[model samples]
Target: MIRLIWTLSAHTRYYLRRYMPTNRLLDEIRRRRNLKWGIPAMLLAVPYLLIASICTNALDQGAPGWLHLVVLWSVWNAMKLIIMGPVSLLLLVRARIAEAVARRGGRRDSDAGESVNHAGAEPLLHR
Candidate 1:
């Protein structure tokens, strides 16, 4: 029961975080506003869920001997999802931070170059 509740809570939080406005902020900061990382993630997740479902169904029944092989596979995939959820979120956050730092550094470098140019320019009166 506790495990079920934790699973539900984690899933809920994952969905909620995806829809939050902060996701947009992160995307903008990361310069990946146009990149769709979700596509591949969903592609991988769909096959995983389908295989898991089939394996679970087979296990619940007295299936052919060879089908038993999938029991562990399904369980492993389920556990992978449980663990990947937080790791993916952390990766997204890290990517966003890296993007922001790169952007800031670029801007600072440009500003410094401009300042140097201005200081090197001779005054009209001096000319």
Candidate 2:
């Protein structure tokens, strides 16, 4: 059992390392992007939350309003998990691609001896 658990853990770690952002800053940006999506998601849920609260309170008079609230909360959390995971992942992948492109462009520019700051202009030589 321990061996199996260890193997699974190692595999999961490897997978995450391969797929997730390698740089610390990029990882942080991914987390912040998730939070940015999450905060507005919770804000948008306010109306449904109010509805659930009303239902729960109304059930105090003797009904099953708690059921509605339970379902609402469950679905809301599930949807958030489902939606945010891919969106944040997409952002991280995009950042990685952009970084790769910039690195490639930087190498090409340096090799060609050109500065993007001055396009098609004469080279400046200091004596």
Candidate 3:
């Protein structure tokens, strides 16, 4: 009984977090109003456009009807997946390369007496 209650509470919390409009999240997006985040966000509009067109057509009671809309929605989502996969992979690879370079440079700095002492005493610079 306790486990079930906990599980329900966890699910409720997850849904709220997923759907709620948090100011912090919006503020961060506003702050990062740059190409890095902007391009992908723009790409996301494709799905919304597909949804809008389908809904508009369906409401008109067109010949092909709901089935056509469903197929289009599926295709739109699939295209989004295909388009985003490569872009995301490229971005991830770039980040990894940057991290590797930073680490390599950081090691050189650490070699120049930036390391903490093994002894209980504070680092030489800190003291």
- Tell me the whole-model lDDT of each prediction, alpha carbons only: 0.62, 0.59, 0.57
Which segments of candidate 2 are over 4 A away from where they belong?
Answer: 1-63, 114-126
Q: Give the per-residue lDDT digits (tens) of candidate 1, residues 61-118.
A: 8677666666565555545544554555666677789989999999999998779769
Best by TM-score: 1
What C-alpha root-mean-square deviation, in Å, does candidate 3 show against the real structure? 11.9
Task: For each candidate, give its TM-score against the true structure.
Answer: 0.49, 0.39, 0.40
Ranking by lDDT: 1, 2, 3
lDDT of 1: 0.62
Off by over 4 Å in 3: 1-64, 114-127
lDDT of 2 at 32: 39
In the range 11-101, model 3's lDDT, one tens digit per residue, is: 9888865764432232333332221453454455466567756776676776455566665665655465445545555665677788899
